[model samples]
Target chain A: MSILEFSNVSFSNEGKSILKNLNIRIESRDYISIVGPSGSGKSTFLKLCNNLISPSEGNISFNNKNVSEYNPIELRKEIAYCFQMPHLFGDTVMDNLSFPFKIRNKKVDMDRIKYLFSLFSMDEEFIDEKVLNLSGGEKQRIALMRTLMFTPEVLLLDEVTSALDSENTLIVENIINKLNNEGSTVLWVTHNDEQSIKYANKLLTLENGEIKSLEVLK
Target chain B: MNSGATLSTSSLIIASSLVLISLFFSYYQKLNLEKETIIGVIRAIVQLTIVGYLLNFIFGLKNPFFTTLLLLFMTTNASFNASKRGKGIKNGFLISFIAIGIGAFITLFILVVSGAIKYEPYQIIPIGGMIISNAMVAIGLCYKQLLSNFKNKREEVETKLALGADILPSSIEIIRDAIKTGMLPTIDSMKTLGIVALPGMMTGLILAGTSPIEAVKFQILVTFMMLSTTSIASFLACYLAYKGFFNGRKQLI
Candidate 1:
């Protein structure tokens, strides 16, 4: 079943088109990697999936319902987006992690939080560390973990590991691959060809805000 | 009981010499302020003279209609100026007007009801002007800080939004910061009330021959009034201005 679908969608900003005539169906648990040059609307396309950027024409549907019909707050919870540069809020790592629950008026689950920390190969003690003092890779890892705390149906990643070293990149890649295997649909935008081919079950090549080709990778 | 004598024509002319002295210094230092200083001095003289006559006429009339109209004029001008700080937000003028109005009305209402100030031209007009002007500054700060914070921290806010957080919860920190920025000036001034500087109200009262202790009491009331004015204005402005950052679709504009 298709988890997400976009039909004849075109998004424009300030009289210029960002993504034009995008028609794609993302099946449940599909791992799709998008690759394109810098101005090709790669990030914008991912943003459209989460309804961050609405289309100028046509419609995007999530779960067979028009994306516009869904309340953005509820839609966003189901379709989470992680940016290339992790934007962490609050002082401590725990603060960032607990935000998902905090908004819902629920208490933080320390055991689950510890488990997520371990999943990112970080010790439980790191939760109390100030976000400002964390290294780049640690910040990215924590950001990704915070997004995962809600367990959304779809995960949209925009070059989340671009700034990480090779070792850190491998760790992120492994975690994402694990998430995909566990049945969450993942759409990742990457500039690196190797990472695109390695993780994606299907590789989508985008050019000039349009998908040039879709190829089966696995 | 006022100790200071009224300035005579020659005394006024002697004070006018201070402007000439400033003009001479500007010329000697090669500063371009000679023209600006001359124009500014002339403008101040003319404007103050006009306001003095106007106030005299209005106070003598003692009509509530004229008094209310004057207050409205002052508020309109103040809110218009305050709106400039919120250029990014739509309906900046209306938001400022409402915020400043609420702050001023509440504070002045309390003053009148408590019998601290009578609802007359002299008491209401001056006191209302001070309250409105301070509220205007606070609301302006709130608008400026809120818009800038939302712009700079877009990703941080959107990240929270993506996590199913409502708009209010998502931008809570920035909102808090904006309100803090608005309240900071009054808070700092209150902290150093007499030590750092003697405020205008106290100085004016002292010069008017009010006893020092009585002047102190009025100064304290002014400080408290300003504290109430600033905080209320900032909170109202922040609440109204934040909605402009997000659209109906819940996306940050």
Candidate 2:
């Protein structure tokens, strides 16, 4: 069964059509890289999966149930979205890291956080560091780590590594790829063509709010 | 000592020349406010003259129906002004009316029931005007803060929303900030009540030959009621006005 599916979805914002009748399906563990022009609805497509903005026409389904039928909060938990521009929450890195647990009414998993810190090659003291002083690449990594705190079934990456240098990008990619191998579906959107084909098994290209091509890279 | 002190028409004419000083400053500084100063003075004279005769007639008549109608008119006018300042919020006038109306009503009800003031037109109209007017200003501040905060903090809010937060949780910080913004002025005024500036109502009573102690009593009453109404109004307005910024999909509009 497909983990996420969109059927005849059309989205319009402020009288301008963003995405038009997009039909998509992704199985569990599918690493799909989406490349598109700025306004070709790349971020909008990811947002729709999480029900951030509902389609004006047709329906989106997660786990074979209509997305709107599920509580939006619960659905968003399963489908975490990482934005293109990184914004750290509150003052310290601890705030963003503990937020996912706080929202779920669960205890913060310190050991798990420490484990994540090692994966990103960040020192443990960075937890208390103020995000205001963190570099853009560092902030982006923290934001991604925060999203992964709860281990969502689907991780929607909307150019999350855009701010990262090549070294940092490779570090983030390796970490995220490990998560993908563990059965978390990854739908990454990026403008870099080489990055699009580097790891993902599938590449989806969009132009003018319509899918231009889909290829199985593997 | 100054009770019944009246300004005759000729006396008023001489006093009116004081406005020329402001016009002179505007001319010297190139402020271009001469027209505004002239219009403001004329409007003040015209509006206050009408209100004075109307208040005199209404006070003498002692009709409860007229008093209630006048209070409603004032509340509606205050609501309109507050709503006009909030162009972004949908149904701003209706929201302001409900928030200010309820806040003013609760404060006035307590005052009337406690025998602090009578429901007569003389007392109720002025007291109601003060309460409703204060509520209007607080709600206007809340509206302005809500509009700006939602716009400026869009990424933070959406990040929370995308992280499985309900609208209230995602918007909680902004809502609290807006309520604080609305209520801060009243709290600051409370701190400096007697020390910084004499309140308009108390000063007027003193000018009209009321005893200093009596004027102080009324000022204290006004101060307490203003705090009560603004706290209630700011809370209600922030909670109610926030939903306007979110769409049915729970996305920030």
Q: Which ten residues in a row have the lowest lDDT in candidate 1 chain B?
A: B1-10
Error of 2 at B94 (Å): 1.8
Residues B68-122, candidate 1: write the lDDT tens digits. Answer: 8988888898889999867887788988888888888888889889988777887
* Candidate 2 structure quality by residue, lDDT tens digits, B36-129: 9989998999999999999999999999999988988998999899999988988989888888988988999999999999999889988899
Candidates in order have lDDT scores of: 0.88, 0.91
- Which DockQ-derived CAPRI band holds candidate 2? medium
TM-score value, chain A, candidate 2:
0.97
Model 2, residue A142: distance off in Å is 1.5
TM-scores for candidates 1 onward, in order: 0.93, 0.91
List candidate 2 stretches off by more than 4 Å.
A165-167, B1-10, B19-39, B61-65, B192-196
Which stretches of model 1 miss by more than 4 angstroms? A163-171, B1-5
Which ten-residue region of model 2 chain A has the weakest summed lDDT? A82-91
Evaluated on CA atoms against the true complex, candidate 2 attains a DockQ of 0.67
Q: lDDT score, residue A77, model 1?
A: 89
